[model samples]
Target chain A: MIVKSDEKYSTLGSLESELAISGLKSGSNLEKLLKAGYFVVTAELGPPRGADRTVIEKKATLLKGYADAFNITDCQTAVVRLSSITGGAILVGLGLEPIIQMTCRDRNRIAIQSDLLGAAALGIKNLLCLTGDHQKFGDHPGAKGVFDIDSLQLLQIVKGMRDEKKFQSGEEIEVEPRFFIGAAENPFADPFTYRAFRLAKKIRAGADFIQTQIIFNVDKFSAWMERVRALGLHKKVFILAGVAPIKSLLMAKYMKTHVPGMDIPDEIIKRMEKAKKGSAKTEGLNICLDVIEKVRKIEGVSGVHIMAIEWEEAIPEIAKRAGLLPRPSP
Target chain B: MIVADIKPFKEIMRLVKNYRKICVIGCGTCVTVCHAGGQKQVSEVAAQLRLAAKLEKKHLEVGEETILRQCEHEFIDSLEGLVQKYDAIVSLGCGIGVQMLAERFPHTRILPGLNTKFMGAPTEPGIFWERCVGCGNCILAETGGFCPVTRCAKGLLNGPCGGSQNGLCEVSPDTPCVWQLIYEQLEAQGMLDTMEAITPPKDWSVGQGGCGPRRLVLEHLVEEEKDKHKIAEKVLTRNDCKK
Candidate 1:
């Protein structure tokens, strides 16, 4: 995603913004998932930049068991896909709840709004909003960008359709889609005091839950989340810390250099680098598991999104080792 | 640079009313750059028209395609294969580009999806401003770079419109009087005398007059067509068939 304009740090306010979250206040999918006491692991499967589906299928199968819902990303990183709609349908047929991640980058308000209805007709329940990366960073550098609406606006869009029964067109929406709207957060990337406040804005904008960017430092996330509670965010929102296992030294370096607002501590980098040959990647993976184990204990965090990338098979092993088996139902 | 803006789907559906086979034509030029009339817009328009047709319980065949620049002859030639295949073509380009398509597809009806707004320039990233009017004359050397004809509400040349009050257009407080803007610029450049130098009356015959206007700046190209309507569209469908 385009490195967003510098985030304005503020306190997560009282739930005074009338975001109309009644559809999800009780019997929503997120409500059900949380009440079910499953650890509620969701993973993002960004379609490869090329036309190849072979790698995607391999990754999809590998991540199947570890996640309660497997997300098929729509043009993630501003790169085009083999149609996330079709990919989501494929995942649905494969016997999984497909969380379709949509962005405001490629479609206008109508297209995005209509696509949600399309997804609903096909039975996708989990929806994630993103103000995707600009087109320049993707494979198709020349494609025109369409930021018709941003992520917070998209959340409000869904909230309006489902709760308010209205479309962007102002006509009464005939076929409103039911969705568990999830927004994104970056605690480590944001300063400690400002993180919760930004998250509160998303919550007030109608996000049912938030899936944060990967967490490398649990202490930093927990401290940031303590402010999340002090600001009273614990009562209104569900926050999920993002967890992506570092597979190699190169991946860690890439997160540091290429990924904006992401900080991979030198200690973690050194820990990954110092491991003996075959064990380094596994050691890095263990750090993610440990981070999740501790973050799970953090009072405000609602869940975790384990994005294992190509090494999806190790997710189950990692979760099992962290004692997150059968995902925390409730 | 493609210039584009979104429009309601129902309005577009009404424009292509009686056509059985509708082809959505996208401009890869300014419309694409504006994120409006490109492959994505074409696809969405095609999809919406299909959805509308399906809702009406009519299986109308709708096709989608785009060309490099609908305003140019070379670009129009690229659509020969797809053009003849549809009963009507809905163009998603500015007024100039749409008329060009109607001229190129002489035997087919050309419909317009977007209502061309103004001769504007990208004011900010993803924003455009109505800056020029192609008024068949330029006084950029004397008035600095601002064109008084387009920016002024009254198109007054010599000085600010009497209706201006406190640097704002009386018609709309939000709009700044162009002459006032020009005055500030000239004063900044020590060229404020340009406003007092009484210019001769404008020659109406020099510009395109009624609807469209075209003019050339000193550094740009211009085309003065004596019979601009020579490529006027003829109705391919008889009145009895479609009311």
Candidate 2:
């Protein structure tokens, strides 16, 4: 079942079912990683642009105890931010588990392979791969992009690091990191049905977890999850459904229109718009709780990440409403 | 640069309390590099603003637009279609990016969220240190690789002052002694004695001049000038945009 992760979390799964299929032993560290059949724990972290460790330290400290693992993005959108490798190392130093986010836009195959080995040397255990945003979307529109590989190809590289136990050429490193791979999906923005097929492919490739984008509709997400289950891939990995609490009616509309795969029905919008003058945000929070309540009853939802952003403190309250009250100790 | 930091969320919410249709125009450049402005930050800010507005009993129609960049007019013009709809635009970019938005949408009020610090270069991976003062001149050839004009406490250009001890700057512990860097670099290149042979005072006028910017016109003559000019002067080509 979907258990809250503020403290230690336990999943309702026959550990044997997960390990027997994947060939990993029960009581393994991943007994926490895989649950029922789908693995769902995921969180997002971005690289800071200027060099000040304060931001990273604060974020890691606040989130380490709550999230299963957090991701450090590469020069996301290629605007020359801090490198994910450096940030990942900092997280390691801080005792927070981090996922090294690598994008192919800035590195060639040689550099990509080199960075992967370096990441392993740093004892990083998780990875999230992306094709990266185009240079046009970054500060350096004039800068050239190097898309020598994409996410799928990067997944193969991660697998090669473990499976082949070596680099692309067959030269083995002194150490190899076992990566629990994950990829992103936007149900509202994807070509309706491609999500399941694509996720199945990612699972077939090596992804252990799937993190969906900010989800506005829980029922719609469940519908998508049902299809992925029917693909008989239910016993393969975990799926963490993303939840975004609407801060305002305008934000509700923005995600609905601009963000891909984030669908908020008119009824929910009307509920917020029709709420009492200053109570619209309150109503929006309730709407999110309603979705969470409905989603918890669904068969396969692993857990949720409340992207409270500046409103991270409200997470305790939202978690309470969603039946995700912090589970203490065991 | 306007030394502005993203005011805490409550402050931004309180400032724009009246505006209903709020458009958050995030930059995909320096601000993005710093994490103050970027798609993820825009998304996070959009989410945060929504939460704050919810508490205040107001509804804000926030639009998320991350353009190619806020500095380029062509990219700034990219917001033409949606500019008419917003009541106010909260810019997540740096000072220059925010100004670009103001310059483009003069009618629509613009707000800044990040504090732009200085004209600094990336010290290492994600660290940027103030390097160039935009002093209207560059004289790196004589000072090894360090610029005394920018790193020196007194903008000294001649030789090491009495304060340079053990190769550390006297002004601050964090500051590296630029003269020591010159000494090390020159010694490595076997030009330490040659540089010391002539330690003349520098003409600081060109730098301190009214313009207050640097210019480098030392060696402009090149055999491939016509070809270089043709490439730049040519109408922009999209051929290089592909992988």
Candidate 3:
């Protein structure tokens, strides 16, 4: 195909087509690290609920060299916040690679495709597909959920757009949105035995990477990983186990009791409660470090995705204490 | 079967406040099985309305009648004479029956005394649960005879969503997650491979969202009627020749 740089539309189309065919060479640093067989470390930045660019920038700066790439959550828990794309763009400007999380709860197929194109156009490389928390849990319970497609379908759609160079309708795209596809796994959720099988299904659907829900019960997670290993899914996709540092005893108790799908053992909660007032955060970090060390040793486990949540400042220290820092240079 | 529940007595009373004479109609089919709008329930509602009106010092005449099926025109036609005598008709049948009565007795004001829940069978003697939304296109064959559209809280085609825990739905710990049941059933049938296939988005046009007041016409039946007309004409011609 003859490409022209001066033609307004053709230039953009050819540029994207070049990137798409080259296996998305300009992909995120996480993709590079995973490809290079580096023990990767990722973190998350929950974009502020309001229009605060500095919040995202500060978090990005804090996590700059501590982690490979951090994810910008798409309205986590269905509570509306800064758009992941915008937050991701800001992180890119701040020299931090971002994995833009996209949820199926708020957008239909058209919006999802449009946002993918827009995100790719703005230099966003990583995409994490999720079936977001139900709207009933969010501030807008009255809002209609447009799960036009679920996470599995979302993964398939992104894969098609990137690999097949076509839309979900099978129409050819001049410029495909090449992304490093990722999907979420909840091992602690339900029918615990089926969780690994479900992860296999996600991988089959074209998820290049997997990030799980926060792990407080490592034994159960290991059982799930065993199933994943039995299927040899670890060889097909990178599995990043999720860990979140509990800031206080109250937070641990809340996650254990209030959060659905979260299985925090009573022993961990008791340990948190026993900690002295000033040392609770330290105890939480220690527990997180322990989980990280243990998870790193598990076969088929690639890395850890530390979700510091609102406590972004603790991520650097956590990564340092956990011996994950001095991130590998590309 | 369409399961229903009786509307609050106060609501029914308020609906028929202006009418002095009311005819309460019931269906003997699905509603009867559900104990909602059966012959027995019709009498119960009539008695309640009568007592309630008497207590309020209002003269009210509540007549009770039960039909074999309110959905069929023949059974509903039986109430032609009795229906006109009443100022209003209180239908203890499902929503379909209430609408059928309204179409049959255009002059009588029809009020629904029961809330039509869903097309479902009773799990036990008294407790009822929804099993179908009548989306028109059924995929029970693929889902191990379990209807994810009706059972899953999100109506997910490829489920169970993350909310499923210990085979129970996150919406309610009491409610068993239908997808989990489907997975187990499919596994038991040695059909776990079926769950691996991603179900495409449903064709809503064939479902409730497509259009309004859907009807099915049998073309062969119409063709048969035409054939009967031709046969009748030939018989008449032969009879004329004899004459």
Candidate with maximal lDDT: 3
- Writing each residue's lDDT as its tens digit, candidate 1 over B7-86 gives 67888877788889989888887888777888998999899889889999987899988988889999889898788998
Q: What residue runs in model 3 are displaced by over 4 Å at the alpha carbon?
A: A1-22, A48-65, A89-95, A142-144, A326-330, B211-213, B225-243
Structural similarity of chain A in candidate 2, as TM-score: 0.82
Tens digit of per-residue lDDT, candidate 1, span A1-330: 111101121111222422223334424444566433333567777666677767667766766656667778787766677767767767776766677888766887779888889987887778888766656667787786665456666777787887888885567987688788877776764233335655766677778777887889777777888888887775566677788889888889888766655667888888888988988778888889878877777765656788776676777787677655654323
lDDT of 3 by residue, B76-176 (tens): 98998999999999998899999999998898899999999898988987988899888888899999999988887677777687778778887677889
List the pairs of residues colliding in candidate 3. Answer: none
What lDDT does the true structure give each of the candidates? Answer: 0.70, 0.66, 0.85
Clashes of 1: 19
**Model 1, docking class:** incorrect
Better of 1 and 2 by DockQ: 1
Q: What is the lDDT of residue B213 in candidate 2?
A: 46
Please report, as a residue range, the 10-residue window in candidate 3 chain B with the lowest summed lDDT. Answer: B201-210
lDDT string, candidate 3, A1-330, tens digits: 111112321111232332223353336788767655566788999999899899887777778999888899999888999999999999888888899999988998889999999999999999999988888888898998877788888988999999899888889999998899999998888777778878888987879889988998999898998898787777677788899899999999888777778889998998898999899999999899888878877777777999987899989998888777688776
TM-score sort, best first: 3, 1, 2
Top candidate (TM-score): 3
Which lDDT value does model 1 have at A179?
82
lDDT of 3 at A100: 97
